[model samples]
Target: MFLVTGATGNVGAEPVRGPDAPVPDGARPVLGGLDDPGTLAGARDAGVRHVVLVSGGSAALADMSDPISRSLTLSERAVRDSGMAWTLLRPRAFMSNAPRWAPRLRAGDTVRVPFPDAPAACVDPRDVAAVAARSLVGRDPRGRVHELTGPHPRDQLAVLAEMLGRDLRCVGLTDGQARAEMERTLPAEYVDAIVRPDVQEVTGRPPRTFRQWAPAHAGAFR
Candidate 1:
């Protein structure tokens, strides 16, 4: 059996809900995080031969310091040391994150964000799931780390323009400005990490531009 942890998160949801979704076919859903030791053990007891761990960006790890990092790191170690075949997927900046700017998208055509020029190639949750499924069922994926992303890189303003069906101005902010504006809106660490180059390296391809991703998800902004 293939066991997937973090089965309800941005990355995990695709496998749980997609057309060829992984969870329903003898695949077990194990809630993730350092706090959930039982969920991990239960999957192991279920005779799961392969495990896939979906982790958020290193920023979240860096922001929380060693606690969250150690927890996820330990979890990865446990799966690997358990003698079960495993694949570790670390994804940066989610394309679905566009929704967080929904209110702003409605307030005006301009979408402002920190690092508007930093250029992130965010990954689609569906693609992340596809990679995870491949790791679970395919050979040679064990012990490998897959850093996933979309097909291109884009900033928030560009993404907003695509969502609004017209030209939208992008206003870039410094880290300090972003923190002041977004701290109450999102986790500070998460906001800080979205613009890193690591987001591009893992997927081996540029992530999808917001122009491509926004139309389908426009309802979130509307």
Candidate 2:
């Protein structure tokens, strides 16, 4: 039995779940920032040998200054020290995150961004899952940190320009404005996590690109 962190994270299911959604079949999930003794004990009870932890962004920020990073770091430490085999996956910028732009895209060709110029490489969640699967069943992926992302780092505007395939308007926001709009719901560490560069060398294959991802998910914007 496997203790998948999220239905959509390392487990690789594709669906946007609100906080209230059921776990759906075949999923045993452990959310971050909570005590995991029960969950880990359950995994142990289930005879789970390998654990795949989907840590967001590239850095664990283990220093734990903030609640979000601290929680993730704590969870990773618990799993690593659990005497069970574990693989830590850190991926930057999921293309699925682009749905945050959906309302703006639906309203007009204009999109607003906090860091339109900051470098970010959109990662495909499916690829992240593949790596996790390899870690679980293929070989010993223990004691390894997989930093995953697309082939090239791109700014928000560039990604949208490529995905939209036509002229698009982009509006830049002040940090204050951006924080109010986006960070309101997101955790502080998540909103502030440093964007790590793409490390395609780990998988021995190129990371998936926005162009490749947009078509399948384009319906969200429309």
| Leading candidate by TM-score | 2
* Worst ten in a row by lDDT for model 2: 10-19
Pull out the clashing pairs in model 1. 147-202, 147-203, 150-207, 150-208, 151-206, 151-207, 151-208, 152-206, 152-207, 152-208
Model 1, span 1-222: residue lDDT tens: 444456667666676666454547566544455235565566667786777777654523444444656666666666667656677777666788778777776787766667666655666776677677666665544677665555445565665665567767767788677667766434433554434333344334454556766677778877
Output the TM-score of candidate 1. 0.70
Model 1: number of backbone collisions: 10
lDDT of 2 by residue, 1-222 (tens): 544445564235533232346656665555643138667766666788777777764135555566766777777777787667777877766877888888987788888777555555567776676677667776544787776666555555555666667567777887678778755445453455443343444445666677777777777776
Q: Rate the local accuracy (lDDT) of all candidates.
A: 0.61, 0.64
**TM-score, every prediction:** 0.70, 0.72
